[model samples]
Target: MNPLEIGSMVKARYKTGAYIGRIKEERGKFYLVEVLAVLKHPQQGDLHNPKETEGVFFHERRALAHHEKANIPKSAVSAFTDDIPDYPASLRTALQQLREDLNGQPASAYRDLALSNMDSLEKDYFG
Candidate 1:
């Protein structure tokens, strides 16, 4: 299987055909891709997370090369939230865990993104 790089768009083999999206995070065995579109209507739970995971992680074996044969329109595969920056899966998961450790309260979007630097930044800016 070809290795998928972060930010690279790929065609993932689905039951009926293929779904196209960008590779967001590469886990050891799977890639957390952001689905841009599918060949047909999505079945129930086809989307991993409507708010978080725009696409599901298909196995590396199921990933196909993105090409003209895919016939996915650029417009279909390019919708992304501009305000939220992409974070590595591990980092995001860790941050979520840290949030849990602290309390159940959700951090603001900016604070969430900067959690890794919270301690140092807090003294300089927050104080």
Candidate 2:
């Protein structure tokens, strides 16, 4: 596809998760994406010190709120050919998927903490 232009619907990878957004602007090799829907929320915990709970500041990663903007790399942005889902519904689906994926894993502090973080985010997002 041609280079994504401003206002193009796109799937973008910010850090650990993916999102659906519209290209709001271009900055060098990155796209300033206005978040429309979340595909996957970022994994919880210290990204810089992955899986290191001891003495590490475990983070509560939250999905970008509806209409929030993030700078995503050009290489990480791709055309989203499918029709966009409404933001609230899309977030619900993404969170459910994350919960299922987390529950399928072996029990660990990280998993439990992640689930807790997800719960907090859900309450904030939906309340």
Candidate 3:
């Protein structure tokens, strides 16, 4: 229930499956994740909630983040499965290139690919 549990997983309404990231707190408010991968929003194809479809926003709230908040709705959240898919080779290459280009440019570019198995990426790239 604690959003800032450091190594907890969570599912956001926008993302189809779940996310694996460390929880972090800033300015007294807790964030569900410290690092999350880009995912296709659940409402991507839906005519409703255009904002979610456009991929402009990504993130889900955890109970710890809003435990005392009354304005936010309380709901059960799902944790991401380790069996996610990794990004395609083409996309991965492009992302690496982009990161190299933007290296040391103030912005930190980290790659978060969704793969059914977490080891897929390492085996493909690192192996």
Candidate maximizing TM-score? 2
Clashing pairs in 3: 83-116, 84-115, 84-116, 85-114, 85-115, 85-116, 86-115
CA RMSD of each candidate after superposition: 15.3, 1.0, 14.3
Candidate 2: C-alpha RMSD after superposition: 1.0
Candidate 3: where are CA atoms >4 Å away?
1-4, 14-20, 26-30, 42-77, 87-127
Instruction: Summarize candidate 1's per-residue lDDT along 14-101 as a digit string, tens digits.
Output: 4433455666765555566665533332222224432131345322111222222333433233323323322233223333454354
lDDT by residue (1-127, candidate 2, tens digit) is 5878999999999888899999999999899999999899788899898766789899998888899999889999999989889999998999999899899989988888889988999899889
**lDDT tens per residue, model 3, 9-105:** 5443323322233334323333444334423212112233332424433332111221221111113234565643333433344334433433534
**Rank order (by lDDT, best first):** 2, 1, 3
Which of candidates 2 and 3 is the stronger one according to lDDT?
A: 2
Please give the range of 10 consecutive residues that has the lowest summed lDDT in model 2: 47-56
10 residues in a row with least lDDT, candidate 1: 59-68
Compute the lDDT for candidate 1: 0.40
Give the Cα error of residue 5 in candidate 2, in Å: 0.8
| Candidate-wise lDDT, in order | 0.40, 0.91, 0.33
Cα displacement (angstroms), candidate 1, residue 75, comes to 26
* Pairs clashing within candidate 2: none
Superior by lDDT: candidate 1 or candidate 2: 2
lDDT of 2 at 99: 90
Sort order, TM-score high to low: 2, 1, 3
